[model samples]
Target: MKYPSLKNYINGQFVASNSARTIKVVSPVDGALLSEVTMSSAEDLNDAVEAARIAFHKWSKTPIKERVQVFFRYKFLLEKNLQELATICSEENGKTMSEAIAEIEKCIELTEFATSLPQIVTGEVLEVSKGIECRTEHVPLGVVASIVPFNFPSMVPNWTIPNAIALGNCMILKPSEKVPVSSGRIAELLKEAGLPDGVFNIVHGDIEIVEAICDHPGIEAVSFVGSTKVAKLVYQRATNNYKRCLALGGAKNHLMVMPDAIATMTAQNVVASMSGCAGQRCMAASAMVGVGPIDHIIDKICDEARKVVPGENLGAVINKESKDRIEKYITEAEQQGAKILVDGRGAKVDGKGGGTYVGPTVIDHVTPDMAVAKEEIFGPVISIMRTNTVDEALAIENANPYGNAASVFTQNGGVARYIIERASAGMIGVNVGVPVPREPFSFGGWNESRFGVGDITGKSSIEFWTKLKKSTIKWNPEAGVNWMS
Candidate 1:
């Protein structure tokens, strides 16, 4: 039970900030204070940014092969300390040990994919018209700020920081206030793995520090993951300052049960998607669009959902306010004529735990106007709607304002092909529940669920880290500015 008292990581060292204040990291399972992380204010943020700026010139000029070596070393260190780090994730984030481990594994996969970034951050050699050959090169954005969310502290940071760093850039991390300890451990591991100072810096604060990052002139770009409202604000503010931004916003994922889909398989996938992480995932299948076996599938999904008991250590919503809001949403939905079909609501949670627990509340007869269906509850509540035809299901999927990810379970290849083409979301799963963590593939949302042009974890991650300058090099071995003229 000996956990390190966390401090902000700056200039390759863990240091106490000017404020010297700490935010106690609490276990959502029992509300017990697990660890204390040093709280960084605007001053600390400025310090980290300044450090990254100072280190940027040297780090970005380093050889790509040498950079790859550091990433390899970091990967090794993570493997060595996987259990300890994952424990911190589970303790603070309240995910099950298994889920936490999987989260770490996914991050490891991303790191492995990013290992080739040194080489894969490649340039293109092109043959244009006549003897004039054109070439394009990829270069790093100077100082980037990555704002990570609480749900996947370690995993998302892998998405945010690795590609940026691999491309010879200095990255400043604004990890979730709820789980900064996990990120502190990551910073510690990266240092052990031999990254240079200022190349990786951690600044901790709520929204104030994040806003400062969005507007910081010294910062060249920003990457973010959070709610849609915040994502839009961050993207707008950053782009307004002429900065590169990759903002992943909120999601209202849909799971469609096509008639051709096997009933039992659909039920299993739905349960895994909705119940896993206690439905706290942004990509969790919150809305079920019923088709093929519309009525029959809802019954199966509801039955499987009923068995998902609210238990201690299963994890709670982030905090008390989150818990209250989720519960209120369920009640309001019920009042709005959505039937509270089955109760997964855990009883009075022990205050020793975060007391932010909401049991799985399943609602049927849900309408578009109902709170449960309309709002992204960010809890273990599932809403079921029946659509008779495939077109109707696809229509329901598209009608949602937030379009992060969507899935259709079907055996018919034609139907699968049609829905995937028609469904308007970033990630789609034909028979899969959650189609996240597919490394080397771009993951993003359309509509309100995402902002900015670059997606993370796929082809877009590479695009996000590097900038392309279309060099129309009209070569006469002569003038440079004259080419533009």
Candidate 2:
């Protein structure tokens, strides 16, 4: 059984890990090991970094139009193998085939959006300051390390690496050790698309390798997407190493319903927003807040949530530990005053709960200080918190530690506008369920929820990849090439 002998894609080749130590890729649906991947260590990360450092010169100097052509081909290759990509994601990541396909669609959009780099990378020329015509041009910041999360194996890579590569920066990616195969496969496809050697490298492993990648002086920038604590660590280390970083942290997204907001629709949106991706998404709805019909809204939400029966081809948590942690949170909540409205884990499951199956568990009368509300469960669980007025709801939301993505389910445009205006979250969705930022827009969290300055994709990505250098071109015919002053 050949399982794509996973290895670090360095210098345009698949380099084997130094040790035979491997991480087994498992299917959360049944807790089956889909494949075994040899883990890369700190030495392997150094090798990949060295390879990227060597490849950056030619890759960066490569013509922008030529680079764009590569992306066009890459898009075609991705579409041609969309099903294969989907299968890989489904097998290892536990996302249903449909969800996996959707993830690919997001990657497709990112690459398509990225091909427009020629237009986006356009600089401006201002003719106002004396006889000087100041012009700006974006230049790649050498080698960059893009660390992606597990839940979003392919989509996240697109968010970080594409922008880095499109803007001429060579990207050395360290995918999650859990689902490293999909990312490694993507690198192969990128190679087939004719991206130069070392233009985009792939390495997979644990903190040993990740720390090395973070501490590497040669890595000019680091873009990380993971938990808040890890993001803080990466940011602190990367900055101390004098490298730039954009580390997005865990989120406790709130979906508040105003008293005037629609009830049935809001409930359904909350269900999908919180349960989609098995609540593994960074912006997954964890806390539900609103002023109107708190009791009725809770009932409506529970009704809709019950619709998400386990083994209905939704998705599973990343691993058993994650699933267990989610259960622990629920169990502790039970010990607390909160009551479980729908025990997705215990109610009914197609497979065993021992396997990564946590359907959509809903809790009611959850307080702000509760562990369920305070923690980032990263699973299909919702803690319904009530407020007396819209003011109280907003205040509750504002008090939370995380402010990643929040949405409002109100037909009332005034209230929606006010929420959008006043909410301190990074991404806001009105009627939309998931507030993941598209390719053209920046995606990030706020406060302790996000670290450093840029986003995974969108405009901030472009900025993250390049260093803006202002050239003060003073050509008065007075400053001749040979004449000083």
Candidate 3:
């Protein structure tokens, strides 16, 4: 099922790119040519930025309540076409149907959160002195942009769009060229939901466009989600240009299991965490540390992993390069003396021999120094390590540079609390594998996982996309005055 050639969404119009270079949007499911996206040039990016800059003046002054109505219609349209969006995401991203659906559901959830902007985007006021009043209002930044990764085509872009626009800021989105189809569809929905022209835009490209976004002076801030290397570079470039930026990087997330953890339940969650989305997500459990004597749990995890059939239980990796990279890590771990308990290399899907499928692979006896154990493989592979105590397990986790998320699987509340307090990661899960916080809690990581002052979602995003404007007024001469006055 080939799709039409993709176009850039600029100023609320689907404009075809003039760039000579184009990228083939191949379906990782079966190596089919789904679409061809034009590589948007830096000139295209400038056009988008200018459009957003022009729209920001009116959009920023638009009342918060009116801005929220767009999201209300957006949420309804998203739910109305949930299946279509999920299918597009699943085809382009190679995630399973259920996973794709869940991604859209998350987008809808964020849209629902954006609809509450009228209530939450409130200001503070107080009479600090006689005849003098001080107050603070959350005002939108002029123009902002979000560079979203391909792993989550719809959900990740929504991470910034709904909140940023609902708060009255215009946004430019650079969707990964690998999976740009869903974002174009999303752009249509936003327009149908009555988002004004130039309020939101989508440009497709690789590094050139990314660097353009960072260097574009018209943009007031930037939000990025990608690999650690790129995330850091984006943060530096954006900040160097004196723009507020938040760049969420890659993670080597660890899931530690205690001896007291329920073997069946723990194994299921561990397997799901490592194999979900083919383990391409940042929140995936790539490192599994068994604290104390938990051979039974390890065996159970391996057993559960073995049952995850490619294309049935687990989806394919993004592409052949990712599949080869994951297999290389697995092979290296085996050569480095780790046990390949369940090898996913060369896994195949029925009638889809060209598909890039990697089954659920389990590597046991992995040490801290192995590349598979230390680095982010971004695949459906779990490296199992053993530690005698929780301290040792956490020591290994803490030593890792990326601190996106860490989870503890145990029934003991004391041990859970102990790990929670010292996990070093920004997000922690007790008995939960993927610890992505729901709405209202905000989502971000510490250390290298995130670069910037605030998170990309929830209330923190409100702060990221808007600036505080404080006003101090004196209606009349005051008899007494304080230092603030």
Candidate 4:
């Protein structure tokens, strides 16, 4: 099927890039072309940045109430077209309908949260001394960029956009070339919400565009979500250019099961977390750390893993490259002496031309030093490691390089508390598999999993997109009398 040609949304309008080169966005579900988008170049980036810079001068001065009203209207528009956005996510990103809807719902939740920007962007006022008052306010940064990933076409961009724009900053969003459709839809909704031209813009391209965003002087800040390698490059380049960057990276989040935890229930939760979205989420548990008598736990996990059929019960990974990488990791793990308790390497999909499917795979007796155990295998595969004690499990979790999230399945309060206190992960889950925080709190990781001081979403996002200024004033009768006084 020939899908419509997609263009970049720049200066509040959809336009073709200066470069005639285009890339096909292929669906991971059936390897079919969903659409084709322009391969944007540095010139396109310059245009978007210039537009955002021009718009920021006026938009930043707009009243806070008026800006919030735009967000309110944007929230309504998002809700109205929720299904359409979700459908686009499913078509291009290869997530199931329900999963895509959930992602869109998260975007809506962020929009709703942003409508309360008045309260969120509130400043502090204090009487420092007699007749002296000090106040602080957060002012918007200019022409911030949100470089989002294909795994979350809608939600991740919302993490930066609504909050950034609500705080009165203009945005230049560079959506993933693999799934650029939803971002254009979002830009359309922002326009309908009365956002000014260039207040919200979309640029579509690959690394050159990203480098443009980093190197351009007009872009004051950037928010990104992707693999660790790319996140490091983005962070380094943006920071070196003196731009504020929030680059969230990859992870190998572990799900620790103690002796007292119910094996069957823990297995169920582990399987769900490992298989959901084909384990593309950064918080997905890539390893299961078992403490004491782990045979039964491993068996339960294997049984649960076998029940998940990719492209049927669970969706495929993002693309053929992702599928091939996952299979390679599984094979390498087996060759390196890890036992494959549940093999998903041979999983198949009917009528999908060997779609990007990797069923739930569980490997047992994996050591902490194994490459598969140490790396972030963003697929539906879980590695099992046996530890003699809870301390050992905690040590393993903490010693890992990526500290995105950690989970412990235990009814005992002590063990759960112990893991919570010592896991060294940014997000901790007790009896929960995926511990992604909600809109009220920021999402971040420690160690190599994240880069930058502030995380994405919540109040952190508000602070990241804005700069603080403090004012000190005194009401004195002789105010004009003496600057020296």
Highest TM-score: give the candidate number: 3
By descending lDDT, how would the candidates be arranged? 3, 4, 2, 1
TM-score of each: 0.93, 0.95, 0.98, 0.97
| Candidate 4 lDDT over residue span 1-485, tens digit each | 44678888888899889998888888888888878998898888889888888998899999887898988998888889989998889888888888899998898899888888897677999967656778999999888999999889999999988889989998989999999888878888888999999899888989989999999998999999999999999999999999999899999898999888888988899998998888899989998899988688778888888888777778879887888999999999899899998888866788987478888898888998888899988999999999899889988988898999999998999888888899989999988899989877889999999999878988777779889999988778554444423
Clashes of each: 11, 1, 0, 0
The lDDT of each candidate is 0.80, 0.83, 0.93, 0.88
Candidate 1 yields a Cα-based lDDT of: 0.80
Q: Rank by TM-score, descending? A: 3, 4, 2, 1
Where is model 4 more than 4 Å wrong at Cα? Answer: 478-485
lDDT by residue (82-140, candidate 3, tens digit) is 99999999999999999999999999999999999788878999988777888899989
lDDT of 2: 0.83
Of 1 and 4, the candidate ahead on TM-score is: 4
lDDT of 2 at 156: 89
Error of 2 at 46 (Å): 2.6
Better of 1 and 3 by TM-score: 3
Q: Which model scores highest in lDDT?
A: 3
TM-score of 2: 0.95
What's model 3's overall lDDT?
Answer: 0.93
**lDDT of model 1 at position 371:** 62
**Candidate 3 — worst ten consecutive residues by lDDT sum?**
476-485
lDDT of 1 by residue, 28-109 (tens): 7667777777667778888898999999889889987788788788888888888987888877777778888888887788
